[model samples]
Target: MKHGVTVALLVVAAMAGTMASARAQGGRIEERALPYTPLPADIQALDEVIKAPLTDDFVAKSFTAPDGRIVPYRLLTPATATVQLAQARLPLVIVLHGSGSIGQNNVSQMTAFAKAWALPALRQRFPAYVVAPQVDVRSADYAPGGDGLLASHPGASLPAILALVDDLLGRLPVDPARVYVVGFSMGASAALDALVAQPGRFAAAVAFSAVPPDRDRAVAVAGTPTMQVHGDQDTENPFDPDHAWAEAVAAAGGAPIFVRYQGMEHRVPPDMILAPGWREWLFAQRLKSAAPFPNP
Candidate 1:
């Protein structure tokens, strides 16, 4: 097997026994089990699953920055918009793909959190826009380093991504009031930093296996309702730093919901996205401020 695929299998299999033990002791990754368990082989097939497009309809989209930088992104419109495309505006969920999903292809990133949103059940219940943008590796080093510090800015894609999001709002039926963000691994770290960069734009966040917080930046976005989930056994991104970050956020008056999966690791089993009303919880959160898409 290829090194990356082999590594992915090992990570998932190794964490399974631990997670099972934790669940037996009442551990949960935010109101749901990891969702891919009891069959190690199933967990191993994640790479192929992630590579396949969740739906054939995700539209190819782009945003051109002022400096002539064009960022590529894939967009999924809900199959059940309430009103006509031009007049309707529903909640929007911005999904950031993990390190493995980064590519110029545009759709590779759609398989992670974005796939969860594409579920037949979720598509019917939480009819909203799902946007997954591809992050290029050359512009920045995405991997968190030795001490769990990311090599680049946590919100490095800030201005460009936000510009794309803003443009989506204008052209598509996206409810500016109900915007939410969710991501795993490097993407998770980026999601949190995105909140810090532009506070009040995103009403809530679900960051899993996220990198350690940029304390100063993290503390700035204390008001946003956020959920942090990590496996104590996560070697890719150590568990303690994320736990401490959530604790610190709460200490600083941010109500971050932290979930420690007993034996989980970096792969984080994307199946958690389909565990009950996870998307609903995200859609329900609303920013207290009246301003739409809060500016930096």
Candidate 2:
């Protein structure tokens, strides 16, 4: 068998046992089960390149929401020389971290997935502002329905997170039409919450292992471009509900790209981050209208 496939099979085999154990102990399966079989060497290298020490260009900042909540976040801007020469407003990408990285340290939220946007080559090619916001607790809420669908709502922290985005848009030369949001696990749920809470605000969104937004709100985000990436074998956030959510979106007249990884668990797929397709797709999107903020 090919090495990658072999490794994937091993991962799936291990997860089956791990999930069984967790269920037996009545424990919640979270990110503590990470470091899933080391990824391919090329992917490993790419991951390292992005998550390496933040260069001097990455700045740490905080935002105070209207509700008086303080949101700590790290912002990455393109090289000063690049920003100055750009004639058009730049895109803004909000990177939300999963629950495992939740904290007030202002640094834990800079997960490898969040840092992918700061890659030197990607930054030079895309040339956008990237912000990774950190919260001290769960940043979103998820309720499972008896009908087997999962409903997602913005947690107390998400309003502040979006507020921070607004604050950045006001002061920075951000192209509202190109605003995008990406997140994983818990953050993934928050990304959908952002979409549901304010429908016309984001240009596009990319969510990984996200619990689908409530079926009722599916129509709200139908117009926005969204891509959901999930593992078929995910136990933390079951795969079936996310799949159902995509179907709901399609039924609501939306075309959402749902990428399924077979035999994988609740972990970020290396391909999603290492490949260039996501970046290409992300940069190609713009809001239908050029409104600078969410429609009130």
Candidate 3:
């Protein structure tokens, strides 16, 4: 009886040790596999839209204006549009790429910025309609000797962009109030120009490492909610211009949110889009009305 009792105790201890080892192995497996999971569903859907197959019909559509200038644009719709539209018309976000991205192959610029902003990833958090308009210098006519003529022609880019927006709105269900615009570098400057030319066309504007338009132009859209993000160490475009513009906008009765990243350069930070606090701050603003109090 004593021998039987001792064997039973040994077997129980051995079983417990085996179970603990199994649990540890399982945990390690989970840790290793979790990172590979595709981003949230909405993000996955957006990424798929970015990577979706394209052809002349699906992309690179060209339109000729009455002035004989040709404008080309690309439009990306959510992959799960049937379901996403059911909830409500998804918000539209117009992404403008920087100067380096200008040319016949403008799609490259939009693709790069969309990926950098993690537009696909953000889709999981917020469903949006993304429109990318490419400004081709080869086709559009510019006034002679204008300083940064390409940069100044918001009319050149704005019409193509707005036409695309209007086309999308006519074809797809979209929420007018949630329309947003985001631009980087040269495109950022163009976004500002757009707001000035057509006041209140967008609900919000986000500019990164951009040169603010002329003060007179900026003041026209002073009431529009705008967010300016720049790195303190940005050499391409000095930080002072952005700071000065933010001050000017605020002085004109617009509350501009200025985010300065210390020890950073011209590139977008890895987690800027996903930062919980920033997201709350972005969604909280009312573009049509007065700006909210400074973020605490």
Candidate 4:
């Protein structure tokens, strides 16, 4: 009986030690809910969601490029983080704002959706760094692609944005293996540009209502995991092209998950944004060299 009790206690101690090690490594999560949802009425609730005020925790700052262009941004440190955990590294989430939110004030870019990351629930559940960069103009340059659709390339501001990310990684406990970018409308297009611009830098990308870049650039981002969410009824940046982009990326051996809202218009669906699954999918991604990426 004494021998058995000693063995059991040893096992329990080993288990506890393993759990502590996991916590020290930043508690990486791999669970994700369903990725696709088609809701017709979700669009109606966006106004309320958009008007939601941003929390005060996101500290405002500005990044100035070598060329002197300034990009205003808001940064949110993990609510649970502190100076004590010297070896801890956490994921970094970059949020891009739509055209309507563009400005140098640093606060206009704090859309209701962008503010969601600072929510107590989200901060507690997925504590990490969140940065929202505001540019004076579109983050990517757009010109007619000669096929009646616009072709996009990285704009001048993008380099600064990327530099800002590097700055954060240098100064913060950000996990380079789990960097992510997300945006809506024009910002969505910029997010894709950023992903392609720095391929292999981002673990994953989630674009909402984005304009597709030129077909030739599809292969550049073929290895990165991506999710494109858009409403079928979108008129601002036609949905068909974005859909085609997804297909093209898939054809180029890229992994892309396209979420379509059947009867919605040119707007981000509030229901999906506020869903736990969205964060679950975003947080589940980590840098991987293999294909057939995990389905979130």
Candidate number achieving the greatest TM-score relative to the actual structure: 2
Instruction: Report the candidate with higher lDDT, 1 versus 2.
Output: 2
Window of ten residues with lowest summed lDDT in model 4: 1-10
Cα lDDT of model 2 by residue, 95-136, tens digit: 988989878888888766866666776678789899988997
Model 3 Cα lDDT, one tens digit per residue, 1-296: 10122221233234333433433333111000001112254344444545654322124466554545555666555557544455755566777777677776646665545553334444455555567767664112223222232223354655666666555555555666667777777777667767776676677787877677655455676667676777788787666666666666766656565666666677544333333234433444444442222221
Residue 61 error for model 4, in Å? 1.1
User: Would you list the rank order by TM-score, best first?
Assistant: 2, 4, 1, 3
Model 3: lDDT equals: 0.54
- TM-scores, each model vs. reference: 0.75, 0.83, 0.65, 0.78
Better of 2 and 4 by lDDT: 2
Residue-wise lDDT of candidate 4 within 67-120, one digit each (tens)?
A: 678988999987554424536467889998888987798888888778878766
Error of 1 at 51 (Å): 7.9
Regions of model 1 farther than 4 Å from truth: 1-53, 84-88, 138-152, 290-296
Error of 1 at 286 (Å): 0.6
Stretch of 10 with least lDDT, candidate 3: 27-36
* Model 1 collision count: 0
* Higher-lDDT candidate of 1 and 4: 4
lDDT of 3 at 213: 63
